[model samples]
Target chain A: MQSKSNNSLIKVRQLTKRFDKLIAVNDISFEVFKGELFGFLGPNGAGKTTTINMLTGLARPDSGSIEISGLDCSKNPKLAQHLIGIVPDESNLYPELTGYDNLCFCASLYGMRKHEREERARDLLEKFGLSDAANRKFAGYSKGMKRKLTIAAGIIHRPEILFLDEPTTGIDVASARQIRQLIANLHDSGTTIFLTTHYIEEAERLCQRIGFIVQGKIVRIDTVISLLQPIQKKHTMVISVLHPDEGLHHKLISEFPEYSIELVSKGQFRIVSEKVINIGPLVRCIEETGGEVSEARRIRPSLEEVFVNITGIELNAMKKEKQKNGRSS
Target chain B: MKRWIAFWNILLKDMRAYYLKPPNISWGLIFPVAWTGMFFIKSGKGLDSIISLLPGVVAISILFGTTSMLAVTVTFEKKNKSFDRLLLAPIPLRLLMLAKTSGAILFGSINAFIPIIIASFLADISHVNWFALVLAAIMIAIASTFLGLFIAVSVSEVFEAQTFSNFFRFPMIFLCGLFFPITSLPIFLRPLSYVLPLTYGVDILRGAIDKGNIMPLWLDFLIILGFCVLLFAISLKNIHKRWIM
Candidate 1:
C-alpha cells in the first residue's frame, strides 16, 4: 500500500545475536524505508524481542552492523538513539511516577527542554485518553492504561522512528484495537515504525510490508499484498457434519479429488482448492454418503494460513500463546 | 550540552522516584542517629569521646547509606527491567551511570552529616576542619556509591546485590579503623585496612575532627580520589560486561 518512500531510514546487514550456544537473531538483513510500517512477525522465542532490543540499543549484538537514518550504530549504539523511540514488551516506565511524570521524564532523557516536555506530556496524556489518570501512579493504572502510557512515553520526543515490541500481546481487545489505530495514525503521519508482533492478523491489518522470522532467521520479506497473492488464488471452506462416520471423510476425499481435504475434527473438516468449489455439489455428495451436513461456509484466506505455510509452524502454537497472554491480561 | 541535560534529568528522575520519598528521607536521617547512639552506649564512651567517635560514625553513615540505597535501587530497577529504559537513552553509558549513582551519593553525603549534627549539639565541633570534613564526606560518598553500583551490576537480583555489598562493607567497618587505629590491628591485617576505601576516608575525617593524622592530608585525599575513580571505572566495566551484553 505504498508504504515505502525509497528513502531507507533503517538498514541492517547480517545481524546476529548469540546467547551462549543459542543464536537469537542470525544473519538477518532488511531495510525499513522512511514512513514505512514494517512488521516483524514471529512466534514466541523467535527472537522478535531480541532483534528489537539490538535495534533500540538495549542490547549489544554479537556480530553484524546496523544503520539508523544513515548513522552507523554498530560500534556506537547510542549515536542514532536520539532519532528512535522504543516501547519494550513489558511496561518499563517507573511505577512510582505518575503517568504525566513518566512521559515528561522520557522526554527529558531525549534532552527536551522543561517547558516543552511538560507541554508535550500533557498533550500526549490527553491524546491517549489518559488525562484523568495523568496524576495517578503508574503502578495503580490498569494493564491497558499502562500500555497506552508506555506508548505515549515512547513518542514523547516525537522521534523519527519508533520500535514497538509486542505492543498488544497481553491487553484487552478494546485496548488492542485502540493501539492499532494509534499505530496506524502514527504511520499515516509519516513516522517510520518497526513493529514486532506474534499476531498474524494484527500484522496483516496494520503493516504494509511483513518480515516472517522463524528460529532466528528471516524466512520471507514482502508487502502484505504480495505475501497474500498466492494464497488468494485458492478457495477454502470448512464444513461441519452431524455424527459423520469414519468413512465419510475418505468418501468425500475420493469424490473431490481436485480439492485438498483435511478432517479438522470428528464433526468438522476443511476443503481447499485452486478453483472455487460449488457448494451445492459438496452438500449433495455429503448427503449421499449418509453424512448430514450441518454447516458449510467459504472462508477467506488470511495471513495466518500464509504464515503457517511459509514458517511451517502450527497455528495451534500461536493460538496457545495468544490464550496464555490473554489469561495473564 | 545535550548530554548534560540527559544527565541532569536522569539524576532528577532518580531523586523523585527513590531518594526524595519521605520514608527514605526519614530512614536516611534516623539510621545514622541510631548508629551514633548505639555505638556511643556500646563503647560506654562519655561526652568526651564523642569527638573521637565522630569520624567513624560519619564514615559508616556514608558507607552504609550509599551502598544500601544504591544496591536496592539499581538491582530493583534491573529486576523490573526499568533500567533498560535508561539504557536506551541517548546519553553515554558513563554519564548515565554517573546520573544513576549520583542520587545515592547525595543521600549518603547528607547522611554523613546526621551524626555530625547530633555531635555538634553535645560536643564542640568549632575546632573541627569543616572543609576537610566536607571533602571527606563527598569522596567517601562517591567511592561507596560506586562500590554499590559495582555490586548492583554484578548480580541480577536485589537480595544478591545486598549480599554482595555486605561482602565488601562488613569487613571495611572493622578493618578500616572505623573506631580504632590501624596500628592496633595485627600487622598481617593492617595491609587489608589500607586496601579499604573507607580507611582513607576515616583517616581524613580523623585528621579533620581530632587532629589525629597518620598520613598527610593530601595523601589521604589523593588515595580516596583514586578509589573513587577506580570503583567508578570498574562498575562501568561490569555494567558493559554483565548488563549490556
Candidate 2:
C-alpha cells in the first residue's frame, strides 16, 4: 500500500440526510486522506451507503458540507465528480453490453479517448481475470464476474479516489478473496478508497483506519491498530469435547477461575481470558474428569470484538444480514 | 470538450443498450407502419388521401415511438439503478438528461419517416417542402421525447410510466388534430388542441406536407419549440426532486 499522506482527498462535515421522518445519515463527519484505504464500518442501515451516496452526488444531503480535493461540493455535488469513481452496492453497468463495452462506455463518460479507453478496458479485463468473458453480455456473467467488471469499470479512468459501497458483499469466498486482493493492489498503486462494508473481518484485513457507524451515527473512528489495542491483551479459545455436560462445565469454570468459560453448544465450550491461557492445566483437568478433548483451538481477537464492544451490536446480527444479502444478491 | 465526450458516450450507450436492440428496432418499424395502416383503414380514405394523412400519421408515430422508448429506457434504468451511473458522470445534469433523451429523439424522428417514406411511394409528394418536413419531424421528436421524459420523471415504475404517458398521449392523438383539423373541432375543445404541443408539431407537419396549416408556420414552430423547453425544464426539475433526492 502507498504510504499514508496528510493530504485529505475527501472531507465531509456535519453531513445529514433525511427521508421523510427518518434521518438516513445524521451529522456524520470524517476525512479520507490521500492514498489511504478508509473503511466506513457499519451494519445494515447504519448510514454507510447513505453517506457514500451523499459524498458521490447520488443523493443530496439536507445539511452539512462536503469537500473533495479542496473543491466545495456542498451545493454542486458534481464539482468533484470528475476526480472520483463509485461502485454502487449493485452492479449498475448495462446488462446488454459486453464487459469490454461496459468498461469502455464508463471510460468514455470520464472523457477518455477511444484508443485510450479501449486499451485501458483491455488491461482491466485481463487484470480482473475477465478476458475470457470479455465478449459475453453482462447479463450472462456470474455474480463474481459481474462484480469484478463493476470494479474495473469504476477504475477505468483511474480516478484519484474510489467509493466502494459493499464491493464484495454477496460473492463466494474465493471471489471475495480475489476482490480483496485486487482492492489491495489498487490501494498499493496509490488510489484513495472509501470502502463501506458490514463485514468486520473485511475492514480488519484491509482498511488502514476504521469508522464504526451504527443507526445512522458514527460511534468511533480510529486506526485499525488503535482500534484493536483494547482487545489485544485478551485471549479467546473454543474447545470441542466428547460427552460434554453441565458437570464438566461447572468444574472447568471453577478450575479456571481467571478465565470465563461457557458451554457454547452440545459438544463445545468456549474459554476467554485477559491473560494468555495455559492449555496444559485446563486440558488435564478436563481429561481427569473423564471428558475427551477432541479439538482445542485459539480464537484471535479481531475487529469483530472491537465492533461489538464499541457498537454493542451482536456479531450474529451482522452474520444474519450477510446471509440475507448473500441470498438476495 | 470532456462534457461533450461524456454526452456522446451516454447517447451511444443508450443506443446500444436500448434503441438498437432487435426487439425495439422491429417494434419501431412495425408500430409506425401499423399505425399508418390502421388510420388509413379507419378513415376509409384511398391512397389518394395519403398526402393529407401523412402529417397526422408521422406525428403519431413519433409520439408513440419516443414515449414508449423513454418509458422503457428511463423507468427501467431508474428501477435497476443503472441511471445512477449516468447521474454520477461529470457532465452537467442538463447535458446528461439531454444525452439520455437524444436516442429517443433520434428514434422518434426516424419513426416519423416510416410513414412519409411509405406515403411518398404511393402518392406524388413532389411538391412537399422536404426541408420543412425534416425540421418538423425533428421538432416533433424533441417535444414528444421531452413529454416522455416528463412522464418518466413523474413515475417510479415502468407500468406507471406507460399509464402516465397514456394520460397525455391518448388525449393528444385526438385533441392535437392528428387525425382531424383543430378548426373542425368544437370551439370548447379547440383550446385543448392549442394547449398540447403535438398540435403545433402536427400543424408544422401539415403545413409542410399539404399546405394545411391553421397557424402560421413560424408560430407553429415557435410554440412547439417553447413546449419542448417547458417540458424539458419540468422533466429536469422532477428528476432532481424525485430521483436525486
Candidate 3:
C-alpha cells in the first residue's frame, strides 16, 4: 500500500487535546491521503470521536495543527470546513424538517443556489434510496432511515474529505450493508474517507489502511494485511482419521516437528502450524502410518484476534471495564 | 450581498418554523391584546390615556417576548448540539448572529403592532403620530433582540440565561413606565427610568400618540440610537469571541 503522505489530503502534527484536567487525545500525528479509505479503529473512549471533532473544526485542539486539503483548519476554519463533510456519532438531523429539507438546509449553508440545491438534493435522495421518504419529517424516520438521511445531508455539497464516526452503529444488518456499499462506492469515486467503527469485520473489509488507537494514542497504524499478518500466521487445521490411536498422534508430531498435534475423541485430530503450508506432508505421513485422512481444512485467524493481540484486551472486556468505571464514577 | 441573503434566509426559515405556527401566532397576538383590553377596561378614560400607554406596552411586550424567545431558542439549540452544525457552516459568524437577531426583531415588531391595530378601530388613533411611534417601536425591537442574542451567547446554560434576563426584563417593564407613567413614580426612580431603553421607546410612543412633548424629539431619538449601538456592540463582541475561539 502507498503511504498516505504522498497524496496527503489531511495532515496532523503532534496533535493534543485536553478537556480541563483530562487529556482526551494525547500527542498523536497521522496523515490521510486522497482517495484512501482510512479506518480509525478503537474501543469506546479511545479518542476517535475527539480526533474527528478536531479535524472537522467542531472542537479546538489544545495544541498542534491540522490541515485539510492544505488549508490550516485553525487559521482558516471556514475554508477548511468547506472542503470536508462530517457525519457525527449522533444523528444531528433537524427533526422538524423533512429529509429533503434537511439536505436543502445544508446546501443553503454552502451557498448553493436554490435551483442547484434542489437538483442536487433530489439526486442525492434518489442515490441513497430516500426518495420515498424525502417529504416525510425526520422525527418519524426509523433509525436506519435517519442514518441514511444524515449521511446524505453530510455529503450534499460533495466535499473532498469525509469524516464518519460509527456510521453503522445501532442499525440493522441490511442497513449496515447498504451503508458499507455506499462508503465503498464513495471511495471508488476518489473521495477520501476517514471512518471509525467498532465492527472489526467492516474495518477489515472496507479500510485500505487501519490505525489502532488505544488509551487516546495510536498504538499501531498499518495496512489491513500487515496488521493481520502476525495472527494470520497461526493456522489451525482439523483432520478426521480412520484410526483412533495414540500412536498416530505421536507419529504425526514426530513426523512433522513444526506442527502441534492434538488428539480428539474417536477419530479426529487437530494440527496447528505457523502457516497453511505443506499439508501434503501431513497427509503423506498419515498414509505411511497406516491411518486414513478423511478431511483436511485450514482456518486462518480473524481480525478479532489481531485486535486482541495488539491491545492485550478484547473489545468486550474493554467495554465491560468502561461500564464498571461509569458505575463507580 | 451574501450576508444579506444569509440573513434573509435565516429570517424566512425562522418565520416559517415559529411564527406561522398557530400557537406562536396566538401567543404573540393574544397576550398583548389581552393586556391592552384589561388596561382599557380598568382605566376607562377617554381615548387619550389609553393611546398614551399603548407605546409603552408595546415596548414592554417586545422586550419581554423577543428576549425570552431568542434566549430560550438559543439555549435549546445548544443543548441539542444543533448549534455545532451552524458553527461549522461556511457562513460568517456575524452574519448568523445578525440573521437570528433580525428574525427575533421581525417577530417582535409584528407582536407590538397586533394589539395597536385592533385598538385603532375602537379608539381615536387619528391623533397618534403613527410614523414616530412605528419608528420608535422598531428601534426598541432591534435593541431588545440584540441584547437577547448577547445574553444567549454569553451564558453556558439556558436556565442561567433565563435567570440573568429577569434582572433586566422585570425592571425594564415596570420601572421604565410601560404600564403607567414614569411621572407617577417617586422622583428618585424617575431618573433611573430615563436610562432604560424602554423609557425612550415609551417616550416616543406616548409623544406620538398623545401629541405630548415629554422630552425633546432629538433626545429620544439619540437615546434609542445609543441603546442600539451599545447592544449591537456587545452582541458583535460576544459572537466574535465565540467564533474565533
Candidate 4:
C-alpha cells in the first residue's frame, strides 16, 4: 500500500517473527496515524502480542522494519522505547511496593525528577480512583486496582505512543468500564493508542481503523464503517417459530441460493440475504416443511456477524468465556 | 547523567525490596558467626586466636549470604514475572546489572562487617593493618557478589540458581585456607586452594591482622580484582543472552 497520508506516527513493513518452527507474525504491514486508536483484532494465537512486542523493544524482529515517529525502532529500540509506553497483558509490577511507590519507580526508570514523579503519581492515583489504596501494597490490591495502577504507571512519562495488549481481558465490569474510559480520555488528550483485543465490540466502538489478523496474517484493514458497509443491504431477519424442522436450514439454502439460512436454536432461525428478502417464500417454505412462523423482525447486523462473515469462524470460539463482557469491556 | 540517575533508582528499588529485609540480613550473618564461635571455643580461646578467625568467617558470610540473597531476589522476580517491567525500560541492560551487583556488594560488605565490629574490641588491634584489611573485605564482597549475580542470571529457576551457587561456593570454604594454613593441605588440594578467589582474600585479611605479608598485598589484590572482572563480565553476557536477545 502506498502512503495514504504523511502524518503517520507508526509505519510497519514486512514484519516477521518466528519461534523455533512457527512463524508468529509473517510479513504484515500497516501504519497507525497520529492520535488514532488502531486496533489489531485477532484470535488467541493470531500473533497480536508478537507484533506488539516487536513494535516495542521487548523482542527483536526476524525481518523487516518498524518506523515509529520516523525512527527505525526494530534496529534502534533504546531510543524508540523512550518515546513509547507499554502496558503488557499482565500488570507486571513490584508486588512488595506500595501503589504510589510503584508509580514513582516506573517514572524513575525514565529518568524523571523526584518532585515531578511525585506530582504525577499523585495525580494518576487520584484520576484512576486509586487514591484510597495508593498506600497499599500492590500484591494486596484487587485485580481491578492492579490493572488501574499498571495503566497509570505506563502513562507516567507521557510517551507519544502507548501499546496496550489485551487491556480489558480479565476484570470486573466496573473496572473494565473505568479502564475504557481512561483509554478514551487518553485518546482525547491527543495520545496515540495501539491496542490488540479479541472483543469485536471493543474494536468496533473504540478503533477508527480495525485490522483483522488470522493465523499471523492480516486479512483486512479498513474503517469499521467501510467493513460493515458491504453487509448493509443484506437482511439478517430473526423469526420465531412454534415448530422447527431439522432439515429447514438446508431446504432454505437450496431454494434461496443467494441467502444463508441458519437455525440459531430449536425455535429460532436467521436468514441472511443479499437483497430484500420477502417473507412470503420463507413462510410458505416453513409451512410446507411442517414448521409455523409465529413472528418475524429484522435484526441489525452486529460486528460479530461481520467478523464471522470475513473469517468464517464464530467470534465466541476465539475468545475465553470469561473475557466476554456484554457491549464494550 | 540521566542514565546514572536511572541506575541509582534501580539500586534504590532493589535495596528496599530485597536487601533491607530482616530475614535477608540475618541469613547473611548467622551461620558465619556461629561456625567461627564454635571454632573459637574448640581452640581454647585467646585474643589472638579469635582475631585470626575473623577474616575467614567474614569471607564465608559474603560467600554464602550475599550469593544466596542475590540469587533468591533475582529468581523471585523471574518466577513472578515482575522483571519484565525492568526489561522494557529504555536504559541499557549493562547499567541495570551494574546497579544490582553494586547493591548486592554493598549489602555483603555490611553483613561481613557485623562480625568484624564485634571482634574489634575483643582482639588486639595494635598489630593489625586496618587499610589492607578493609581493601581485602571490599575485594571479597565484589568477587562473591558478582559470582552470585552470574549464577542468578544463568539459571531459569530460583532453586537452580541457588544450587549452582552452592555447587561452587561450598568447595571454596574447605579449600580456601580459611580453616587451616595452605601448607597443611594435601599436595593435590593445595593447587585447588590457590585457584579459588577466596584463598587470596582470606590470606590478605590474615596477613593484615598478623601484620605480615602473605604473598605481597599487590599480587593478592590483583588476583581478587581479576576474579571480580571475570565474574562481572560473564554475568553481563549471560543476562543479555537470557533476557535481552
Comparing to the true complex, what docking class would candidate 2 get? high
Candidate 2 residue-wise lDDT at A88: 90
Query: Best to worst by TM-score, what's the order?
Result: 1, 2, 4, 3
How do the residues A1-329 of candidate 2 rate in per-residue lDDT, one tens digit apiece?
24332488888899999999998888988889989999999988899998988898988999999999999998998899999999998988889889999999999998999999999999999999999999999999999899999999999999999999999988888889999999999999999999999988888999999999988999999999999998889899999988665589889988889999978777688888998899889889888888889999999888998998999997768778888877332
List ranges where model 3 is wrong by over 4 Å.
Answer: A1-6, A236-299, A318-329, B1-5, B154-167, B183-195, B211-245
Give lDDT tens digits, candidate 1, residues A1-329: 24443488999899999999999999999999988999999999998999988888877898899999989999898899999999889998899999998898889888898999999999999999999999999999988899999999999989999999999988898899899999999899989999999999999999999999999999999999999999999999999999687788888889889999999879798999998888898888888767898998998999999999999998878888889888332
The DockQ values of the predictions, listed in order, are: 0.81, 0.81, 0.33, 0.69
Which pairs of residues collide in model 1?
A: none
True contacts kept of each: 0.83, 0.79, 0.38, 0.65
Q: Which candidate comes out best when scored by TM-score?
A: 1
User: Which DockQ value does candidate 1 get?
Assistant: 0.81
Give stretches of model 4 more than 4 Å off: A1-5, A239-243, A254-258, A264-268, A277-299, A319-329, B45-47, B211-213
- Any idea what lDDT model 4 has? 0.84
What residue pairs clash in candidate 3, if any at all?
A: none
Instruction: Tell me the tens digit of each residue's lDDT in model 4 across B39-96.
Output: 7887785665777788788788877767888887887887776787777788887787
Report the CAPRI category for model 3.
acceptable
Q: What is candidate 3's lDDT per residue for A1-329, written digit by digit as tens?
A: 46546579988888898877778889889988888899998887889998998887767788888888878885556767778888887788777789998888877777777898899999999999999999999889988888888888889889898899989877777888898999999899888899997667789999999988887898888888888777766878788888645587778878878878877546677677775657787788788778788887776566766888888875567556545533221
Q: What is the C-alpha RMSD of each candidate to the true structure, in Å?
A: 1.8, 2.5, 6.1, 2.8
Clashing pairs in 4: none
Model 1 C-alpha lDDT per residue in residues B1-245, reported as the tens digit of each score: 87788889888888888888999889888877887887789778688889988899899999988997898999999999989888998988988998999899998999898999899899999999999999999999999999998888888888898899899999998999988789999999999998888999999999999889799999999998998899889888888888887
A1-329: candidate 4 lDDT, tens digit per residue: 34556789899999998888999999999999999999999887899998998898767888989999988787877767778899988888899999999999999989899999999999999999999999999999988899899999999999999999988877877888888899989999999999898878778888889999988989889888898898877788988887778787788888888777777778787888888878998889888989899999998876777788888876457544434433334
i-RMSD of all predictions: 1.1, 0.9, 2.7, 1.4
Looking at model 3 chain B, report the run of 10 residues with the lowest lDDT sum: B1-10
Worst 10 residues of 3 chain A by lDDT: A320-329
Per-candidate TM-scores read 0.97, 0.95, 0.83, 0.92
lDDT: which is higher, 1 or 3? 1
